[model samples]
Target: MPWGEFKDTVAERRIFQHRTLVALMLLFVMMGVLMARMYYLQVIQHDTYTTLSDKNRVQVQSVAPTRGLVYDRNNVLLAENRPVFNVTIVPERVADISQTLSELQAILNISEDDLDRFRGRLLEPRRPFQEIPLRYDLTEQEIASMAVHRHTLPGVEVNAELVRYYPYSELTSHALGYVGRINRDELQRIDPVNYAGTNYIGKSGIERFYEQALHGKVGYQHVETNARGRTLRVLERENPVPGEDIRLHLDIRLQKLAHDLLDGRRGAIVAIEPKTGGVLALASVPGFDANLFVTGIGVEAYRELNESLDKPLFNRALRGQYPPGSTIKPMLAIAALDSGSTNRERTVWDPGYFQLKPTGRRFRDWKRGGHGWVNLKDAVEQSCDIYFYDVGVRMGVDVMHDYLTRFGFGEETSLDISGALPGIVPSREWKRAHRNEPWYPGDSVNMSIGQGFNLATPLQLATGTAVLANRGVWNQPRLLSDVLGDHDFEEGLFGAARDDIILTDPDTWTFGIKAMEAVMHGTKGTARAAARKAPYRMAGKTGTAQVFSLAEGEEYDEEEVRIRLRDHALFIGFAPVEDPVIAVAVIVENGGSGSGTAAPVARAMFDAWLLGFPAPDEPVLVKSDPGAGE
Candidate 1:
């Protein structure tokens, strides 16, 4: 046993040495592989891994620019941005959107409209991690409640944003219009990068006209976020550029005066500064609050406004088209003189009515027993339909159309006023195209008296009157006076280039002005009562536009016809005939008489703008005077 043990010792030693060498070689190989992997990760793929890590901790966000401020000519703020709290949600971070929305509804008094709007917006294409607004204008209590329950909600947040507000909402609704939330159609048309975080866009009026200058450039920021996607800090920020501030030609004092003048009525008054073509005041009565549409008008509120019989939402100044009535006499008189159809000395016999032929239909004048014989000046002063009927037929449709177009009729003439209609100026072609009928001789007669197929907006009447006031010069009606920033105001926008009217005889302009002046100052003038005791000499033409036509020989009974179907009162005029400062157009819906109802409104506007009397706050009552005729 001792001899066997001694003989195995050398073998055992050799076996142990070999086993130790093999173990050391295996350990060295494992160490080399580990070092190679460490080098590949730390050196070769360093940028890639670092970028991945940062993606989990950081986020890029868009910063919205502040919308431009809007002010009147006197620096009175019309539209402004007010800070508001809104509840927003990030879809990617929410585990269940439906469940989260339910929770939000319970937390806040969210209406079904808001929920529906949110859900609809959720399906629209958007940025990967954009925060969608759920509820707007949250109260402090609602904000506190949301904060208390924030932990349970993953991706919900309360954000402060600048929302549009109108200080004189009711007065300026149709003039300034309003902004609204950007819809999907707007998103597609807008510059994505520039409007990334923007929510509102101009919908109409001054807001829509200068949208590009009002909406500034967007910005970007790098923010650090936690594992739960909550923003911890802003790493880098590129401050956004604020929009350009705009000042309108609108005078707030004059606007208020115009509104007060039309108090308790359904009507419109447009006043323009003739020298500069600046719109001083644009007032549409029974106007709804424009502020209601800023955030989002309630369904019921919007429905009520949309369905109201008074049509408070209608922009009568720019869109309401009606027969110009006898108010068109001044312009037609100029046409007659220029076309050699009639002379200042030419006289037409008016026996209370006119007929194209001896056997033709009798076109009755406003006066039951009209003035016997009248010259051009006498015709204009009396608002005589029969005299115009004679000259209008001589001048023909083509001549009237050409001259009226030059005076800014049958077409949109405003440079910045939006939604203005090119009122109907019936010609052979127009009648053929629209009504599929030939132009009738009676059509020309009706058009001569501002009836039949001829229609015009109050703004158009005002613009035409402005041209007349300016001695055939076309300034192109505009609202924007100046822009207070890098952006400059663009002129001649959305309108044809200006071409001043030059007559064969330059004295025609002077003649037209004098004839219009006679309408206000002359003893037999239709609007003489309205212009009585005026310190300055003004030019005016009053008219009564029929709401419905009478049957062949059927007499008009104002008492029998409903108030809604009564004649519309109209007046177009300008103050201080020598200097020609302000041109105005006034229309009172179903107010009966132009001299009685509409002329007084224009007188008040003139007094306010020129004389600064009967202050805006003064309790001035404008009543219909039966003595005033035409």
Candidate 2:
């Protein structure tokens, strides 16, 4: 016990108290800093963090509106919506995507294409916990099978939604068209907010023409979801407004009749009501089932359709460009009379052929010994080529082009359907632009026969025929008759009356109609045989267009060539000549004679529309018009 160690106890105690006070002050400063940090996070930044946390559990979902229904004039459903089951997966909930996909493959029988498409979607930008579809349109058995294994799968879900369905798929595919899944390109172009939950988009025909009206507005809902992102309850909802219904002017019965008439041929038939220009029936043979394109068509099926020899996917009625041949005679006759190129009393001698320049080139008429001294009426009724050759040469290419353009040739026609192609009407500008050659006298002569560079679609021919039936009052051909949408849209949306084709002399219409009538009722008319058994008078014209060019001086012997290389047969007509009802244009590919093949088909349609369709009960009206062809 040293004296210094024992006596310094009070001083050591004071030093220890000083160290404890310093440590307490430092501790108090650290606690104060931590409290301030906590207050900043919990109070000032509270809303931001809470919103982030709630988004992980609660979700705002887009609700797709119901698509519109499409009906024919008789209320027959052409296109409708049907509930289809789709299997979707949420990537966030899927713990091991590979394992989950394998399990889904076993349960859903997913194809390799489905997996590829799913992976492609996964690469694209999307909302959190959004369902990505793996397969569409599941069968009842598949749905039941998925339900049995539902508990085993965490992120998988079976979603039900309405999809487009065309009941008369083959019959009305060209008229109604179809919808398909929206693509990346379409996504860039479409309204993101409006099409939020929408998947399918209209691809062609009427469906494409009225896509906006058919696809209704999008809706929204506040939903509470669990940790796995399953919707537990709907907190608030805004109901969607459904799409409007559309009614077409097509008559199913007449459409079927037209189809039956052109059953075996690879040609098109377009029939329109003379008054309103409402298309009664538009048929292109060898059509495909339009449903194959709705829900992501398989590569194999698409390839098959794309490679088919018959071209079932082609809309021949609107897109097919064929040589108009004698079908142009009626239009030319009107042109000849109205343009002051030729008079009705004019006549031309045909020694079985025509020449742009004598001893230059001989363009042989269809008959070896041609029509003798053909007049304008005889030229149209018999479809005499030599008479037109003289007139066409006299009028020249420019006048013919201008006159024919007025008749809707070489133009888009501006129809409601999206597939119409503006057929070629050979002009000096068109020839120089496309063929890089100048228009020649021989070109004019060939155009007279609709041979050289002249091209016209069946729709164009039908439209021209309808114009004739309407007597210069042009009504553009249309399929949509009524659109039952919001704000009385039916009148505004569909069946709009187009501009008329006003003629210089209205009496020229009577002249053309009288000549067309002679085509079926006259003694030596080309299509006179077709009018033989008919109970009603019809104005018609027969046409024969060469499929392959005949070599100089090579005769056209149809039986010698291959079936596909033979001439195309065609006819155009309207029934009950006094007050026309139906105007039709029929074309039969490689069927030899227009009178023998195409004329009969037009006669059948005329009978079905004028006589057979109206019941016998309306006897007075039916008997009022003269029966038994002249």
- Judged by lDDT, which candidate is best? 1
Root-mean-square deviation of Cα positions for candidate 1 versus the true structure, in angstroms: 3.1
Q: Report the C-alpha lDDT of model 1 over 1-630, residue by residue, as the tens digit.
A: 668866878889999999999999999999989999998998999999988889999878899999999999989999999999999999999999989988887889999888878888899988788888989999999999988998899999999999999999998999999999888898899898999999899999989888988988899999999988888999999999888999999998888878888886888999988889999999989898998887778788889999986899999999999999998889999999999999999898999999888998998888889889999999999888899988988989999999999999999889889899999888889989988998877888988989988899999999999999999998888898888967655655555667999999999999989988988999898888888999999999999888974578867556655676878999999989999999999998888899999999898888888887574456876766634577
Give, for candidate 2, the lowest lDDT window spanning 10 residues.
621-630
Number of the top candidate by TM-score?
A: 1
Please give the distance, in angstroms, between residue 388's alpha carbon in candidate 1 and its true position after superposition: 0.7
Please list the residue runs of candidate 1 whose C-alpha ends up more than 4 Å from where it truly belongs after superposition: 1-23, 488-496, 549-561, 613-616
TM-score: model 2 vs. ground truth: 0.89
What's each prediction's TM-score? 0.95, 0.89
TM-score (C-alpha) between model 1 and the true structure: 0.95
